[model samples]
Target: MARIAFILLCHKNPDAIIRQAEQLTAAGDCIAVHFDASADAADYNAILNGLQDNPNVTFAKKRVKCGWGEWSLVQATLNAVEAAVEAFPHASHFYMVSGDCMPIKSAGFAHQFLDAHDCDFIESYDFFDSNWIKTGFREERLIYRHFFNERTQKRRFYWGLALQQRLGLRRKIPEDLQIMIGSQWWCLRRRTIEALLDFVQERRDVMRFFQRTWIPDETFFQTLVRHLVPGREIECRTLTFLMFTDYGMPVTFYNDHYDLLLGQDALFARKISVEASQLHERLGGLYASDQMEFEISNEGRTLFQFLTGRGRVGRRFAQRFWEQETTLGRNRELMIIACKKWHVAKRLVAGIRDHTNVPAVEYLFNEEDAALPDLGGIETTLEKRSRHRRALMRMIFDHFESDRLIICLDPSSLDLMSDFFADRATVRLLEISCSFDDDYLAGHARRVGLAGPQTGADTMARLLPTIRHDMVYERDMMRDADFPNMTRISDTGSVDANAHAIAQFLGVSLETGKTLAETPHLFVD
Candidate 1:
């Protein structure tokens, strides 16, 4: 059996670490905990005490002080790996994960997956064009820290001055030259870990140069691996969750929008704080066994469809159909609105009525006498397009209730809705475009004064009608173009016109199980 190692850097929050460690231990994997020496000894002792029952867990010597944006943390991790290698020489592979990370897949499944891949799974990417400016700042900060070290601060300054004189230089050296980043956590083969350790020990000058660098955690492993095993089978991306943030600081798991992350097929998630209880509960029992058939739920599928560029109309149609046909009725209350368009809102109301058949109250903006609950309203100038849309959406989302469907007529209304609800919000955006086309093609456009000569001309020349006529003519032409084969026409008429047209042209179902009227306007332009 392949062996895996769980290396965690614990400072505070020992409970989370212990819980994770216990889960890993239950799967028959070895656990190694490395506490930062700078952390309180009482905390460390508490962590050790909790792990006393676990036979695989062990403590390492050579404690190091880990500072943010410094090389010390990576050094400490390397030291722990060294210890694990010494103790488990016969082990096949070693996986590195953080205390904050939780496995979405079972250990047996994860082990088998890793065993199949020969490459190291560390995320390494060129930082020059990416959003890695903070990495450069951290590097400069580390240089300053090293230059001003208390004991050798003056000696280092004089040595730098002497070196500058020897090189005939007057100005200070430029610091922000080259920077690269790799994820701090990774899983490596036992031989790979030994190779990295040997490389570090042999290349003292390189290690010393990196020691005074900022955010060395991002570069240390990358530089070593890239030099040692250039062009080897290494995964450029980490199997981790994409973090959501505000002002460069982690905010939440983006759980309110779990659909966004679920589509990515990531192997792990990180920095999920304790408040993401709903996300935790939803993800629980996701991949509990190796033999378990992994299938996304209907809700998961609907969310993925939206994420992959299917607009709100498609999502609502799929969701309503799914709910009626499947056991996903329990989560029907989750509502997500992408934008607030007045017409879209009306369709949303219509869709809700069609699916649930519930008696829903309607309120118009100008209807002062309409009996309705007090929902907040927002006003924005037409000149401020983005702001106007944002404000309208916010107001609509604020008034939205899971039990009651909120219809927004304006696409601009989705702007604010996106902010309040996560990717998982059950709120579906109704396609106003589809409804508009349906109304216009079915002669309702003239009543709304939107149908001009140009509108009628455009619909008459559309592809759906042309294709439908072409198919009919082709069948007749094949049968000698006479009225003798009129029986085939009856058979074709029994076939769903919309379904046949959509299948022949678009290769998808136009009908949503609950049929809408057969109108040319409902077809995509």
Candidate 2:
């Protein structure tokens, strides 16, 4: 068991601070708390009383009156380290977090991940580069003098710092030292923390220089580490996901951010508030688990699964497919179910239905297809792979029973259509793309990892001629006038929106200018 020493730098959210402290406190993984001295004394004493009985939890003896962009924040972090070192000397790693930050990954997974790779997880970027953030953030933070004290209301800003920089009044950096900037939150080795403590003690001048600097917390420790090591990228990116506002302050998260939280691979997220207490509660339960089932499942989750879940994407596609099949399938002439180019299929079905109405369409992909993606590399057994394909065939055929059947297919869908559907029916391939240029199709194709322009063009050349005898409609979405007596449609606009010439091809006519908002879908099957 590789136990960690966790330090929390907290200022607000008393309930969140108490919960996180209790959650991270375990037998081997010790937790140390440092509530800002500026906070209410009663709140501080209440937290101390709550955690005092827990041997694994400790409190900072020297609480710093922390303020944003001030030295106090860094001082508080340093004090938390001193608290942790004293309480748990056998700790494997030292990690800093905030009161608002809640773990996304389980602590067991975190311990395993840290134990597997003995590398530092710190994010540091050069002051000279604009690659990480906008240039203005750097200029104001690094170039000029900045001083602010929230408690005492002391403030100072001097443009002379820039002029002095022009006249070379800047303090000389030793050739061995270089500056780097990064997020204040960091996880480091025992040796690294010791080294930083020693460096600060020895170089009071260097620490004082940073004291007058703007937002010193972000720059102080990161710059010192880079100055000491001089030219190596951070081994691990910071695990916390801090949503930033337009003003660059950390944005508070809520329930609306729950999906975004799921998508992120981070262990922790920041700036949570009372409004999103439900999010915090959910995250708390998740972090306590020993293993993450979703991590393994997420890798194999494909577009098919997302499509079937009737999520936002699935609902959009369902609504579009329904507009046509709702009317046309009832005629019993011939219906093709193709989802190879899912995005194009949506547009084509929606656009075609605008002019040609169809019956309620029924397309079925089972729980397995809707659950897993194309597992070409994953499922390598003939028996398993064969079974997977058959499952999909069963799903496709279960819907339409007719001699006339041509389904849209992708590499993930199936390899051979002749096996299940029977080749008796003449297959009329209706290939629809926004344009011959992959850039047009890329918006949709890229999601499934089939966005290569040159590759798509090459496939078109081979497949179109191979089935030349039965090919019916081979039209590039915006390029060709293959639909005689109809105007060409632009790929950029939505077909339902009456995209001028594009809508004309679909034969969608409104009452003068009422648009899709009024007539929407004209019934025609």
Candidate 3:
């Protein structure tokens, strides 16, 4: 069995910290806590009273007043690690976690996994090579000295930054170390930790340089570990499950996400919501045996896809419709089937799918779930209001095997449709006119209730003009003269006939049993 020493950095929530520490110690793992010196006296006393009986729990003698994006946080961690190393001399590894973090898996499983790897699991990536930092200043965080806390004293932080820029003053980093950055949460071998402590003790200039550096907690250990440990011994990935939003804010978990967290490959989850007592109760004492083979779940992938669709790119695309509509490129093989009534358009899409082998779906921008693969996250009212149509289109195009896609358009989405097809030079738009009776129109009008009562002809007049089409299947004789690219469906009334017409329009022969791959003209020219 691998003896692990957990270094916990706690601030508030005494009960929660007690539970976490007790759970870890219960599993034969020792814990050393560094409660923030700035925290309430009552909370700190409560923690002491709660865990005084546990022999495995130890507290750091030297406490620091920690602040966000400050060197104090890293110093606090170092104090706790030193206390842990001295207390538990048999400890093989040291895992650092925040107060809000909880283990999703059993301690036995973690020990097993760590013993198998035998290397440090910490996310260390090149500071400049990848787009690792999301919101704040990246290279500037190191080169310039930041005296004010960016979160608390925003005005002072900016003023200090401007003053530095005016004076052309820059801090020189230690030549021996390459500045690497990653998640502050990490698990490292005892030897690596000892080497890091020794390196920090010897290098007084490094301490002085990082003391003024911005957010040194993230870069301090990450940069130093690379310098001390060999590249082969470092895994360059954290075992903790940490995810951030587009604004670089951490994602907090609640009670409902129990299954999602349980299914993840990560041993620990960070920054849990304080209100999640039920989540704490469930995962608090839960431990899996070594005999149980853990199968990695798809929940992580699903959650990742969900978060990706709501990320910065998705939000930007969503907001674009308000300022100016973006013209979609016809570089990919895409087809649009528009009808006044969604049911008729859905039926046409069904016929297309039945006859041809091309990928087809109904309502790519429906208010409900999108008919594309893995788009369940785009269903909220804010998501719909943001008008993430282009993002949806991109996902639809990317989901299928090839770049070809056939989508049915709801009449409600005509404005979005028009925006996309405004500069349509290559995309094939097949518009099918549907006849809406008086009853249907009145029901729809009652449901909508804009300014006045609407009739069937009034509805048709409003919806028909926005559709851009290369070909028209005039099912309703009332609008036969409305389209210049008219192909009368009167000649082909049957589903099979209409299917054949669509297949021929797409350059696929139904009689010869040709697939989309065999038809080169549709995709190429």
lDDT per residue as tens, model 3, 396-479: 666675566777665434445445554342456565544444455444434433112322343334433322121122222214
Tens-digit per-residue lDDT, 55-170, candidate 2: 98888899988877788888888888888887888887888887778777778787877787675667777766736656444555544455555335543234454466677755
Flag the better candidate by TM-score, 1 or 2.
2
Number of the top-ranking candidate, with TM-score as the measure: 3
Candidate 3, lDDT over the whole model: 0.70
For this target, which candidate reaches the highest lDDT against the unseen true structure?
3
Candidate 1 stretches with Cα past 4 Å from truth are 127-131, 134-179, 254-264, 275-291, 296-433, 436-525
Q: In model 3, which regions exceed 4 Å deviation?
A: 288-291, 307-420, 424-427, 430-495, 503-525
The deviation in Å at residue 211 for candidate 3 is 0.8
**Per-model tally of clashing residue pairs:** 29, 13, 0
Q: Is candidate 1 or candidate 3 better by lDDT?
A: 3
Q: Give the per-residue lDDT of model 1 (tens digit) for 1-525.
A: 567876777677777667667766676777677888998888788888999888777666677877775577788888788777776666666666676666655666667777777787776665555665552243243344243332335586446545755776433222432445677767777777889889778877667777765567887776566556554777766766545332455434535644333333455566665666666545433434454333222222222222333122322112222122222123433232221123333443455456443334333222233334443433322333233333333334345443433433233233333332332334332222222233333343333232322333433244234333433333333233221101111111333652343232212244631243233223333
Of the two candidates 1 and 3, the one with more favorable TM-score, higher being better, is 3
Query: Could you tell me which residue pairs clash in candidate 3?
Result: none
TM, every model: 0.52, 0.57, 0.68
What's the lDDT for residue 370 in model 1?
A: 30
TM-score of model 3 vs. true structure: 0.68
